[model samples]
Target: MYSAEIILEQRTRALSEINLNGFGQRHQGKVRDFYSLPGNRRLLVTTDRQSAFDRILGQIPFKGQVLNQLSQFWFEQSSDILPNHMLSVPDPNVMLAREAQMFPVEIVVRGYMTGVTDTSIWTMYQKGSRQMYGYNFKDGMYKNQPLATPIITPTTHAELGGHDKPLSRTEIIESGLVAEEIYTQIEEKALALFARGQELCGKGGLILVDTKYEFGLIDGQVAITDEVHTPDSSRFWIASTYESRLGQGQEPENFDKELLRLWMRSKGFGGDGAPPALDEDIIARLSQRYIGCYERITGREFESDLTQPVAERIKANLEGLAL
Candidate 1:
């Protein structure tokens, strides 16, 4: 459990450049570092790096723990839906997982027609395009309105921070990115997972607005890889205010990283180019938002060892682990 002042007072930092000497070949990602290991396993280290629109904003202290722990929680909660790559949690910020061959697409399920990114349905619709990601929308749709039904709007899985292109069901099937049977299986799993997420979030007074899931083929079976529902991979809105806010044509109260995105955009960076350095104050607030979501979702306090350096703490916790 940490307060904003506690976060700001912590001297230890875990940046994106951290390296584990004994770990195998490392593939650095935007917010995570993947280390390949023997027996088709991998060490996934979640860093405190904050990202938006496929661009790194800054590092939020302990944000990695929030993301890693949240993913573990969701994966276990939804394990009945499909298998996952998670092997164990060696540290709060690390996941030792099966090195499943991740698919080239990201399974994004949206319950509402909203998002500010270029690939978001709302953005595309606002630009006068009624057709997007294999979903047809009528002209009367308002921003943040719920869709007729939840839909799978998949996107190209851009490794690291590259742009993610939208993919329709037809394009995905016809292009042979994945066999129809396999893709459809994952699709059903994703939808079921989303429904499960909504059911769980409802009890917590949050709406599972939309979330992205990554599935990979492991042991000849489709298993979810990377993560499930987390602040970085999903959108969460306050459920009680959603209806009133929608009726008033106002944005619903949310605790996702879109706050950081809006702050970045206000600074004249619309994710088209490089962004200016983020202030420490905003970074602290962002860390609080992640913590808030974790607490609300799991109904548990987020515990972190602020007295130790994040990278050093990870190294110590992972000392005896077989990667």
Candidate 2:
């Protein structure tokens, strides 16, 4: 791991984008840049661009490598529960994955009534709506409190620069977004994945609070796609400090991107308009946090290859794959 000073110096050096020629048709998502590859596969290059509430905030040094590697870790750990699009990781920040027809709505499994985003279970619960995501919420639930059981709240995938809207199981099926039978299988697999994640995270003294799971049809069968249990796609908290802090009505120590979201919220920005420029200090801190998340969750040390520029390294590493 690099020191704080090195991380701060790398703020401007973070990789925000990398477009390779001859990589076939390219599609840009919030964080990952996808390009069609041979053998009906896709090359997913995770970038350092930070995003929340469906908005790109900024970039953090080494953020791409952390997210890509962490996702690769969980994908291997939970392959028995469900297959993912991951095929190989030739580069620390890139993944060669099987192409799948992605389902339009993402399945969110929440073990807690938390989050500040518009689609958060807590946000909707606070709005005085008892019916949410096809589940009825009774009164007396406190912020950040764990629910009796985890719930699956589906949300539509927003276009670039568009806000995400929440959906229920009934709504998803009724809209023809997904068939009833396949959707049920997706839901069951999603819960199983969450349980696996929670079991592993519990051993590490972290709580896998909630996470968003996306699925796609691979060979006409359901498969987890995009990233899984990555800090960018999930919420985590320190378990030891959770009950104590919540008893005092304080927020738990965040171990995921929620820390950054909370910071963005403090800056008076949610998901609307342009986000303020990320300061050097915050960028460095977020970078450190990303590295820490990788270490804590995977039980591995976070290391960066500082031999060359990030973009140059990635380009060279991918050149062989283009052959």
Candidate 3:
């Protein structure tokens, strides 16, 4: 792992998106650029482009590599629990995966009542909403409070320009988004995965607050799709400070993109109007936070390959692939 100073100095390239037109049919999502390959496969490249509340914020250096590698780590760790769409990671920011019949709902599992997004349980609860996504909460609950048990809150998988709306299990099934049996299977799998994540992250001195998982059908079997346990897909807080912070009515130290969101919120931007230009200092700090989370969650050092440009490195690494 590089030192903080070294990591900042080496964060030279930030990938916002990839334009691999000739490679295959390209589909650019919010953060991932998909290049469809022959034989039901695709090259999924995670970019550094950050988004919050359906708004695209500026890119963060080394963020893509951290998210990709971290998700790869979690996918490997959780492979025994469920099959995933990942075939292999061709590059640090790329995953060669099977093209799946994806579910239309994103499965979100929460162990606590906290978050700043409108779809967040805490946000809804504060707005005088006692019931959310079929889960009813008692009147008295504080922010960042742990729940009696984890709850599954699914949301519609909206397009890039749209917001993801929360949905109940019944709503999902009634709306034909997912069948009841498949939804039950994924819900159990998601909870088990969350337990495994919490166990692993606890050993690493971090709290796996909550996370969203996407699933898809691969060969008629439900498989974990997209990223898992990444800072972009989950919320993490410093374990040691959680108790004291909550006792003091302070938000715990979060390592996810919530920091970026907080910064944007302070500047009076939340998925509206034009986003303020991110300065070099903000980008550097965000990169450091992402690296820190990666190291904490995986218990490994993050080594950057700064010798070549990101695009060149990915292209060279993927030369042997079928894409």
Residue 86 of model 3 has an lDDT of 86
lDDT of 2 at 231: 85
**All models: lDDT?**
0.86, 0.86, 0.86
lDDT (Cα, tens digit) per residue for candidate 3, span 1-323: 44546545655656777776468567888889888888898789999887776767767778899989998999899999999888899899999889999998899999999987889999999999998999889998999999999999999988766789999988988888888898889988999999999999998899999999989999999999899998888999889999999999898988777878878778898677898777666777788888888998889998878776677788788777665
Instruction: Please give the range of 10 consecutive residues that has the lowest summed lDDT in model 3.
Output: 1-10
In candidate 1, what are the lDDT values of residues 1-323, reduced to their tens digit? Answer: 57667878763565565688877578888889888888998889999888777677667887898899989998899889899999999889999899888888999999998988789999999999988898778988889988888999999987664779999999999999999999989999999999999998888899999999889999999998897789888999999999998889889998788888778878998667688787877877888888888888889988888667888888888887655
lDDT of 1 at 36: 85
lDDT value, residue 46 of candidate 3: 91
RMSD (CA, Å), each prediction: 1.6, 1.7, 1.7
> Which residue pairs in candidate 3 collide?
none
Each candidate structure's count of clashing pairs: 1, 0, 0
Give model 2's TM-score versus the native structure.
Answer: 0.94
Which parts of model 3 have CA positions greater than 4 angstroms off?
1-12
Per-residue alpha-carbon lDDT of candidate 2 for residues 215-289, written as tens digits (9 for 90 to 100) = 999989899988888888888999999999999988899988777777877999866788777787778788888
